[model samples]
Target: MPHFCRIVKSGIAAPLLAATLLLLPPAAQADHADWHHGLSLIDKLKYAPDFPHYDYVNPEAPKGGDVKLSTTGTFDTFNPVLDKGQPAVGLALVFDTLLKSADDEISTGYGLLAEGVSYPADISSATFRLRQEAKWADGKPVTPEDVVFSLDRSKELDPLYANYYKHVTSAEKTGERDVTFHFDQKNNRELPNILGQLQILPKHWWEGQGPDGKPRDITKTTLEPVMGSGPYKIAAFSAGASVRYELRDDYWGKSLNVNVGQNNFGSISYTFFGDRDVEFEAFRSGNSDYWLENIAARWATGYDFPAVKDGRVKRESLPNPLRATGVMQALVPNMRRAPFNDERVRQALNFTLDFEEMNRTVFYNAYTRVDSYFWNTDLASSGLPQDAELAILEEVKDKVPPEVFTAPYKNPVGGTPQAGRDNLRRAIALLKEAGFELKGNRMVEAKTGKPFSFEILLSSDTLERVALPYAQNLKKIGIDARVRTVDASQYTNRTRAFDYDMTWIVWAQTLSPGNEQLDYWGSRSATEQGSRNYAGIADPGVDALINKVIFAKDRDTLVAATKALDRVLLAHNYVVPLYYKRDMNIAYWDKFSRPAELPTYAIGFPTIWWSKNASPK
Candidate 1:
């Protein structure tokens, strides 16, 4: 349940559920008419009402030792949901979600903080009944008031969450532990599941005073430890360097069938570094227990250290077959700017970069060139729109690019010097068509003589490798592209505000696409500050298609609508297509043991893997 689109670093009203909370009882063997223990999006629940622990977990996995990890940025606060400061990692371990997503299946969730959840045939609303045992760290039972407070406050605080919960109009207490959410629209499947993904907050704690003897404000950032029903709490920390969470000895839900073999760590710690090289070095030198490597060059050659060769450190590539698909990993140009406003100008920039040559020279030839906004999935548009997808696109033929109907969209190709030259020539022609002319090796507006130059803002110095090469390529095409690398804080602030001309961004997608599409490309979000509409997409066709996806009647319609939307987004060229590797690159210390079959969609690292030693000492 990637509940929302993560910037590859990493759903709104996405009727993402299509059946997000569809509870089909084995005994009943029919449609959803009553509440059940498990929740799913399929015709039948993956785990039956009387099912034991999940199949992917070790029912008796020992849990004692700690796991150490690394993060490459500084954090100023523990309030992750707030828009204010950089929230520390490991905060997720501190809070319990209303439901748990199934690893083997897609768009399914099981009650975690709540014992069970109920929804109607129309899916206009969902009611969650908290477990009697669910309690905050301070020993307060999690009530309907807490659940209501969580939903109302989250939408009020962040625009991202606002877009996610836009259709959800109100929440109220029905029964003793029951909290009900009413929706503004009907049949929005994703609303239930994303709401199921809600991390229940403690209203009693936040309404009270902090350690400093002042009333706690949920809207503000804070370093004071939070009270939660989850298995971990802040044990120790430095302001911006490190944070450690100790497993709660009295965690309320340890015995819950859904939590079996999970939360195995006695303690979990995250050490922060300012650089990836330093972070990798720390993981290599045994400062940390595991390393989920994302850089291809490092995975190819950086493991020359002795530990990797020896049995001490293990390097393995895990494939996530059930992992959610469709990622636009690209240098996204801000559409609010003058140069990027023209479709031809954007296409010209896409032709300038040589991804194949870059892959051969820098990426170790490990990745595949991404073509579709939703690549590696059935939902991605292919050779041509046909049948249902074609019909969906024809509705707003005028609002979208004509090529979306007449021709298939593909990135301009380049590998050799000749191919690169040919692409640049095409780029030149496109620029000319867009009323820009090459003069003295500088691209400028042909009529007014306004120079076209923009900076590619980047957060990590490590990404400088990719940006620098692309910028050099652009320079060859008479476009002055400068690369500027800043610290994490500045990068976060700038990107959130959409301040750069272009920046490396990753827009991740799940199998079930819904309301979050509006947040990504909606017309209203384009002008709204802090919205994720990074490319400034404001097309009525996109909005209509997005609504189609959100309100898609069935799974087939959702897929077709998603494909139509993907086809339109690509035809417009919002981001310069980048590359992606399917297998997860991971290196870890050989000190832990895990289930023989891991979750199909996730690695289930420290959370599910227990130390072999099984000793806190």
Candidate 2:
């Protein structure tokens, strides 16, 4: 859910996470020893408890080689708990969660740090039995105190953590290796699985003095490499220039069921570049081993290199048809501001956007217009809301827009000059009805004579191609639209404070979306600083619909409620929907070998892919 300013996402292929803030093991079924090892919400656990390794992994895969990846900006802090500095990629490599989620399964996970877990029938509280083998880099045992400290510290430091784990009321060390998390509410199905994903921090090291002899504050950002208990540790670094990790031979979980053929790299490294183009060039030059291509034009035309032509570089479009990604990549309008706060003004902005023209011109026609908040999923509403979806909407019919019942939500089409003019007239008419007037070829507020204008804030100039044309369209309708590009930090800060008139925001959603819906669109989070509610949505109907989604009894109920919510959100023009890619476009040097099968939802890159340079035994 946009990471609430902490994790600025760049990869479109990054999944709508199973858990909102972190990846987690699947949900547990009941309170028992058998249920301790694995969990599932709606379906049977895919892999048995005694399974040796994930089916998508090479159970006997070789484990040695170094691979370099590319990053655009510098990373200042190694501390991932704070919202301050950009946390480096592969931070997860250094830490471990209680349970690990299998890639192919949508709602199942197995024990990792925790050997077993127990929860109440109602799922009010969950107890995790820590593996005695788990140890920090310095050989200190991972304890229940560490788990308690991790939860309290993370919630205190990161807003995303605070929001994600808000339902977790308290954590306590119940036994020698048992840490139990108590929930504030009952029958909230996703809590056990979410709590299992709590990234356990080493309490002793964090509370102690650092190399500077200063007591470390988890709330503040730091460059000091964190002490962790995972498969790899920070071996070398030059701040943002580059960072390398050495896989630990002494790693505690090396022989576990989940770790059988994973973390096979002897070393993994990342090099910083000026931009994505430079990064791609680095990959083409064999400096980095892998690349995820997002630029449509580059993918369609730029891969004429000799390596690609001769098959030295492998390119694959990995498509998972069953994956349901609820992604909204759009221009988010801050409703707290004027003109945007008015429905007519917001609707007018949508009419000004000629997606078909923009798709052909800027995006190389490689994208599908995002039609729903839950697009590319069964949850996306179409035509008229019928049956269950209709029933759900009827409860809030008065609270939502009247057109929701009378009209289907469809973005205006404009590729031809005639269609463009038609859409332009529609936009002007909406503005006129909203007390705006086109005087001397410029729209001004009828009450105060202020020009209909606002800035389109962007983090990178890559978006200018899209925003500039949109700005031109707005100007054509006698509205003054300005475009501004700033650094990622400034863009994040401004958006966090709700200071921007409009900006690019993406809210990635999972197939099983729950609790986090509150942080996404709840009225309470609208004013809350560091919320995923970037557009400041606070409609009563939205609030009611979100609650319905959160409390959905079964899968059918969840889908219907989500579709109803989508309809209401579309009815209001909070975001000018943009384009989205359905599949992952990836290219890599032919120096590595992955399992014959890959994870269902993700590409299983460096994590599950092993280097082919290792000697066969």
Runs off by more than 4 Å, candidate 2:
1-13, 19-35
TM-score between model 1 and native: 0.95
Best by TM-score: 1
Question: Pairs clashing in candidate 2?
Answer: 26-108, 26-109, 27-39, 27-40
Off by over 4 Å in 1: 4-33, 615-617
RMSD of each: 3.2, 2.8
lDDT tens digits, residues 247-332, model 2?
Answer: 99899999999888889889999887656677888999999999887788888999999999999999988875226567778998
Candidate 1: what lDDT? 0.81
In model 1, the worst 10-residue window by lDDT is: 10-19
